[model samples]
Target: MKKICIALDYNPNSEKIAAIGHAYARALRAETILVHVISEAAFYAMEYEPFMGYDSPFHLNNLDMVKELEQGAENFLLAASLHLGTDGIKTQVLEGETSDAILSFCRENRVDLLVIGTHSHSVLENVLMGNTAVKIVRHTGIPLLVVPTKMEG
Candidate 1:
């Protein structure tokens, strides 16, 4: 059976990507693996902090924060799996660079298709903030299905 990997970033458009994965899997009769990559670096950098020694309390606090964020990411992925389960999709959670992890997982699992969600942001915004979907598309060799977030009515 063919394998499909759907990379979920826990964004507002996650459900739309899940739906696209569901439709694709149904049409292809392939197994779906929902992958969520939690970047510890990104999570930690979001908080401002002053420089501290290697064994300082600030370092420990940041480590704890990263652990909590990882746990939250895992929980989110679990909840997503349960929701997508209603549509018969399997899910998995991972931690690392979002694009690199997804591509590596696809290569390891021999995935034929990858699904991702894209936010509608301006070029300048994307240049400043970066886009995971664009990075994944550039790095992966397999076919990708990008589900753009719907505009609010």
Candidate 2:
């Protein structure tokens, strides 16, 4: 059976991505894995570190901030899973660089297809600020589906 992995980011348009995933999965009869990658910056802000013996007050305060972000991310993912569950999609939450984590998950799971959303940006802006979708396409061997957000009519 073919397996599909949909990368989500807890964005406002996630439901659109999920809808696309559901439609594709239903048509292909593939199982879907909804993966959300929490960025390292977010994790660091959440104060998730192996060693807690830091001597700096600034580091300690940053750690506390990170913990709060982590908690929020956890809650967001949990809610996302519950919402996506209604569509019968299996969900996995991971923490790392967005592109790397998605690629790694795809490679490990033998993902036949990957579906992800692209936040619309001008060509100049995209070039200036590297887009995740572009990076994934450049790096991954797996088939990719770039779902553009619905433009306001």
Candidate 3:
């Protein structure tokens, strides 16, 4: 594989995922692209709930907040790229449906391999969240490596 795209999310297991991707990239002698897809729900929640005390509807109207989120996502990817410890590592932040965005990126970039982290989820959580990993697997032609965060009981 000449190019590997690592799908990242804003979660505690993200650093671990990056480490795994880094190791795989080194072993394969592949270029790495760290990608983070921002969720619109998360953007509003971060701007409105904690900071605005959930009082103002202004967060929904705030374009600046969306821009801020884009910047933050880019910064997060940059930090992850550094953590991967490879000069060939690149970062990208895209907004939209997570799985679709990731799949499109892989297709457009000619990625040979796709890597993502999956968390163990309860039945209800899986039903509600609708596993992005599964969706990506169903949709993408690229080879995928899913690194589980931990074993479930």
Q: Please, what is the TM-score per model?
A: 0.78, 0.75, 0.85
**What does candidate 3's lDDT look like per residue over 53-146, in tens digits?**
4567645656766778789999999888877667868898977899988998888989999999988888798789899988887898878999
Q: Kindly report which residue stretches of model 3 are placed more than 4 angstroms away from their true locations once superposed.
A: 41-54, 57-61, 151-153
Alpha carbon lDDT at 8, candidate 3: 91
Across residues 1-153, which tens digit of lDDT does each residue of candidate 2 receive? 399998878678987887787679878999978788778745344434456675543346786766676677666656765765555667676778889999999999999999999987889988998889999989999888999985778
lDDT assessment of candidate 2 = 0.79
Residue 18 local lDDT, model 3: 87
Error of 2 at 96 (Å): 1.9
Query: Candidate 3: lDDT over CA atoms?
Result: 0.84
Clashing pairs in model 2? 45-66, 46-66, 46-67, 47-66
How far is each candidate from the true structure, as Cα RMSD in Å?
4.1, 5.1, 4.0
Q: Model 2, stretches more than 4 Å misplaced?
A: 41-58, 61-71, 85-88
Task: Name the better of 1 and 3 by lDDT.
Answer: 3
